[model samples]
Target: MNLMFVHDVRSETYNEETFARSYGYKIWEERYLPVFNKINVCFRNKDTNVDLNGISDKSSGPKVFFDKRIGMFKGPDVFFSRRIKNILRENIRNNDAVIVRLDSFLGLQTISECRKINKPYMIELVGCAWDSFWNHGFLGKILAPYLFLKTKIEVKRAPFVVYVTREFLQKRYPTKGISTNISNVKISKQKESDLNGRIEKISRLGNKIILGTAANVDVKYKGQKFVIEALGRLKKQGYTQFEYQILGPGDQRYLLDMARKFGVENQIKLLGSYPHEKVFEWMRNELDVYIQPSLQEGLPRAVIEAMSLGVPCIGSDVAGIPELLDKKWVFSRKKDKANEISKLLKKISKEELKVQAIRNFKTAEEYDYNFLLDKRFKILEKYKDFIRREK
Candidate 1:
């Protein structure tokens, strides 16, 4: 069937080119691309400066333009552009199914247009957008209620909502709509030789890599500052061998200041984003532990990738993390941050670490290509019947 996959946010599609080069865009290119006969993905291309040619079966449309100087007023432009694109695409395909990954301003427009046109569309709630904005202090307190209301209205209009995290399912997913929890997709196994080479390079940089977390450092909700603080505490306890690597790009100056303020600048490595393949290779080969300290998340793709490589993860017991990981690996959501870090570190004896790694790998296998693909395809297939019944 023809499928129009709308990626309203460009950052979601090509923000990290370096990482994508090394590992390839396996999540979308491999996992979701084959399900449909044809697919069109729309995304922003300006900031990412990425060529979407090889990433998907079809090219991504132009970036949504907005007046940065005007700020809030820029919303309508995006909303209309997205709606126009969906309407045009829907007309071209006649009676194709559409899936909108609503992480952009255009999503609201697309949803509205779909309703007006009586199109069969599904919304993918990758995460709680409202919470993500509020946690980062981006969506001001004054506007939060309005944003929540807007989201609630849009979500309710969709016939099907796919949530990546259980937190989203419990807190925000509409009870009246048909909702499904489908966690992040995983990459298939790569060559062991490649994985080893990547690991060696990362290990050669330090003796004991205590913790690692990767994200656009500028996004405050990622909780990068908390990880830095935890690193400082580890150092005070004489864990000098430990090092933390912050991957991805965005506001390096701010991150540097944070590291210096924590007095752990020397222990933190700011690896500006690498190609996707190399990033995955490095994760598979070099990283000893993966930590997701995000204040909020839907289901982080990075965490799932790390687990697939047998890297034990220590993430905040928030959102969908607890659903993905075992109870033991999760740190208390309300515990003292430093104490939680200490507790996780204390559990990693060499033997226990190996066992945990294996367990993580096994858990990750459940989200592998075959498993996720089957589930997703089944959902798509069911959509055909649901649409007919709706008519």
Candidate 2:
């Protein structure tokens, strides 16, 4: 059967020859290719600068196809034109099934078009629109409640819903329709010796402790700032053996400036984004602890990946973070996350780190690739069955 997947995710094209996504392109083939014979993705075009160098990991081999005409239109930041709406109408009319991701301008608009023609579609609820917008800054604070309500109403009426977060997004945006909680994290089993290596690393972590987080520094809600602030608090209390490594794409000037103000400038290392293999290698070799200090999240893939590596992790209490970690390992979601992080980092012992590593690796077993694949396969099978009956 054919599928038309709708999302507002940004993607770039190479002269309409090859395509790439900010999220890896392999995700398409991995998730949809099993049940869907042919998949046509309808997503917003990436209008910003399309750098050619080192784009292979993203553009490697995307099996999904796209409509070049749809790619020509402006993205969600701009107004949706009538011509685009007409194109989407025709696109939906041709496909057997439509899966629209929620909490995006284009996705909501597509839902409107689907409903107008009495078309049946499914929803993918990944994150809370409320936390996303409220933490985005001034104008976002004003629009947060509106978008949150809009998303809630949309999810409430959808015929089928898939939530990435097990509990967080499910509670925030519920549905009376058929729904399932499935996280997007995929991890591989670690060797038993990997835990021994973590314990060995902690034994040697006497004077210096290496900490790291992977996220775009440009997005404030990722909570990179809080880590720096927590380090600052540690410094003020005469603790200065911590080093922070950041890995992701974004302007680091803000974080750098904050690092300097916090008097931990020398401790900060902004290692730009690397391929998945390289990232895992870095975590295994260099990191003493992994931190996901995000103010919001959807069961962050990074944390689970870290867990798979036997790296002790700390995350904010919001969303699915607490679900991944124990209460003591997580800081509160309030404004003083830095304080809570500071206290946790200060009091957490090496023995506790060793214990966390062992426990975390065990927890990660549930997200093993084969296990998740079987789970998602069943979900997609249900989706296909439901769509065929409705259409």
Q: Root-mean-square deviation of each candidate, in angstroms?
A: 5.6, 2.5
User: lDDT by residue for model 2 over 1-391, one digit each (tens)?
Assistant: 8888877665666555444434556676787777787778777654435654453236335557776566544334323488678878888998888888866667877888889988888888877888888998887798788888988999999988989887888888889988887777766666888878888888888788899998878889999999999999899889998999998876889999999999999889999767565778888999988999997777888898889889999999888998898678988878588898898899778889989999998888877887777777887888778877875
> Which residue ranges in model 1 land beyond 4 Å of their true spot?
11-37, 47-95, 138-140, 166-171, 175-177, 189-207, 333-335, 385-391
Clashing pairs in 2: none
lDDT of each: 0.64, 0.80
Q: For residues 243-267, what per-residue lDDT tens digits would candidate 1 score against the true structure?
A: 7888876678887887888788998
- lDDT of predicted model 2: 0.80
TM-score, prediction 2: 0.91
* Clash count, candidate 2: 0
